[model samples]
Structure formats: C-alpha cells, structure tokens
Target: MEKKIKPCIDNEQILKQRFLALRDTLDLLSGKWRFCILLNLHYHQKLRFKDFFEVSEGISPKVLTSELATLEAHQLIQKKVEYTPTKDITYYVLTTHAQEIWTVLNTLIEFGLSNRQEVIRSFHSDKN
Candidate 1:
C-alpha cells in the first residue's frame, strides 16, 4: 500500500522564525573551511592550529586564522593554550553551546551523499 504524505503549513511568524534560525546556522558555518574544521574537530576531539593545514590541503594560514576566529566568536569552538616545558600549543575543540550543531551536521552529511548520487546520475544521463 502507498502511504499518503501530509502537507505542512506554517504561519508568517513561524516562517520568519525558521528563516532566522537557518540564517543563523548558515552564518555560523558559512566559509570554505568552517565545516571541514568542524568535521576534523569532531573526529579528532581537538586540534592545534597547524593541524588544520595538514588535513585541508591548499588552505592558507590567513584563511585558517580568519575561519578559526569566526568559529571562536560564534562559540562553536573553544581555543586552549598549553604550555609545557619548551613549547606552547593551541588547540581547538568544540564547545557545549555548539553541541546542537552535531545533529545539523549529520543531516547535512546525509543530504550531501544523496545529492552526490543525483549529480552522478545526471552526469551519466547527459553523456548518453
């Protein structure tokens, strides 16, 4: 049996609120390196400034600095400095405030994979 899909409706205020929320999310993660940095920190737990360059090729020091600053400002990540005996190291880690983003990130991952399949299919169809 085929299932029926319900049509959803929202009031003006609700639409505005939803738009603002999405805008805020995009503002926080909008950048070439923001999502990549988030992904790395999620998997690695913590990472030093220099470590980003290793995982993300073709990224410059300036861009990384800018992206890190934005993430820090938005409270998506925290920066910690460690000083041992001879050297000081700075690490970037996720903050509790931004923990909610993990759910959004997972949704994005699924959307990305599904979109990739569609793109590949379209490309193959175009070639035929």
Candidate 2:
C-alpha cells in the first residue's frame, strides 16, 4: 500500500534553534579561506600546503593551518600522508560529505551572481 505523506511544520522554538545552528555552521564554513579551500580540494582532488597557499593567495600559514584543522575536525575533509620518509608530506582531499556541501554552495553561488549588487549593498550596510 502507498503511504500518505503528511506535511511537516516546524514550531517557533524549533525554527529558531535550527536557524541558529545553520548560522553557526555557515560561519564556520564561510570564513575568508574555508570555502576556497573546500572548493579547491573538491575540484582538484588533493593539494599540498604550498599548493593551497598558492591557489588561494594571501592566506597566511597560520590561517591555513587553522582552517585545515577546523575542516578536518568537522569531517568535511581528509588529510593523507603520502610517501612517508624525509619530506613525507600530506595532501588535503574533500570527504563525501563535503561534496554534498559543494552542491549546495554551487546553488548559492548562482544565487549570488544573480544578486551581486544587492549582496554588496547589504554587506556594506551591515558594516555601518
């Protein structure tokens, strides 16, 4: 038998909680370098520390280290040590979960492109 689907609604408390959580998550992922780091890994498969620094120019070593640690902690990316010996370094690659996030971020990019001026104005206004 086919089951009937009920439309679900969120009450005020749940809505507020969810909104706050979303804001927090976005804040973490939308830092100056986090989004670019994620996109680079997603598109390029993997990158070394210098590769990341080169691709997303102007990111300091300190910021890159912090962002990479945060992304790894969030389970959005993975670090693999390759050729262990001497220089034996690691590369960053996106986890499956990060791919899912990339899809949503692409949608947001499209939306932002369509509203670039409005977004700029809003951002500038918020600073005052």
Candidate 3:
C-alpha cells in the first residue's frame, strides 16, 4: 500500500515567506568580516575598536569601523563609551538578540569542518 501525504493549503505563500526571510537574513549577515566580528564578540563578550583591529588580522581600521557601525545599527551589537580621566574608550558588546545567531554559527562551523575534510580527501585522492 502507498501512503499519501497532504501538503499545506498555503504552501506557495509559506515558501515565499520563508524565502524572503532567508534573503533578509543573508543580507543582514553578508560580508567577509561580519561573521568573524560576531564570532569574536561571542567568545570575548566585549571588545574595543583597537582590539578588533588587532585580532581580526587583515581588516583595515576603516573597514572595521564600517562593519561595527553596521552591526550596531542593526541592533546585533551595542557600542559603549566610557569616559575616563585619560581618554574615552569605546567597546562593542553583542546584544541578547545576537545570541540567537550562535545556533546558526555552530551549524556553519560543523558544515565547514565537514566540507574541509571532504576537500582534503578529494585532493589526496586526486594526487594518487
């Protein structure tokens, strides 16, 4: 006996909504350094502009400033300024909303690890 599966009545509309949602998410997260910056914040909790530049190797001060502004504008990260006798220091910290991205980041890390292993294996096989 063959079993029949029923599809949702609003399948097309649901698919469209999901597609748009994914597109929006990608647009928000798109860029070479966004994820890297987010990951550093996730692990470090907070970082200053100079700290990011030092840790993110290869990222220029201008690009880091731009990316930090974008993240702050999106509400994914918050910028804090401390006034001191010596100078004002600024730091960036991830928002609670940004915690949701850990799940996505973990999934990406897993996929990347698996893909890297596969690529290495393929390269070795090709060498044979």
Q: Tens-digit lDDT track for model 1 on 1-128?
A: 99965436446677778889989888778877899898888989899988888888889999999999999998989999899999998899999987778898899999999999999999999999
Question: For each candidate, what is the lDDT?
Answer: 0.88, 0.87, 0.93
Model 3 C-alpha lDDT per residue in residues 76-123, reported as the tens digit of each score: 999999999999988999999999999999999999999999999999
TM-score of 2: 0.75
Q: Please report the candidate that would top TM-score against the real structure.
A: 3
Q: List the residue pairs that clash in candidate 3.
A: none
| Candidate 1 runs further than 4 Å off | 1-10, 125-128
Ranking by lDDT: 3, 1, 2
User: Which of the two, 1 or 2, has more lDDT?
Assistant: 1
lDDT of 2 by residue, 101-121 (tens): 977779988888879988898
RMSD, one per candidate, in order: 6.3, 8.5, 4.6
Best by lDDT: 3
Using Cα atoms with residue i matched to residue i, what is each candidate's TM-score against the true structure? 0.82, 0.75, 0.86
Candidate 1, which ten residues in sequence have the lowest lDDT sum?
A: 4-13
Runs of candidate 2 with Cα error greater than 4 angstroms are 1-10, 84-87, 117-128
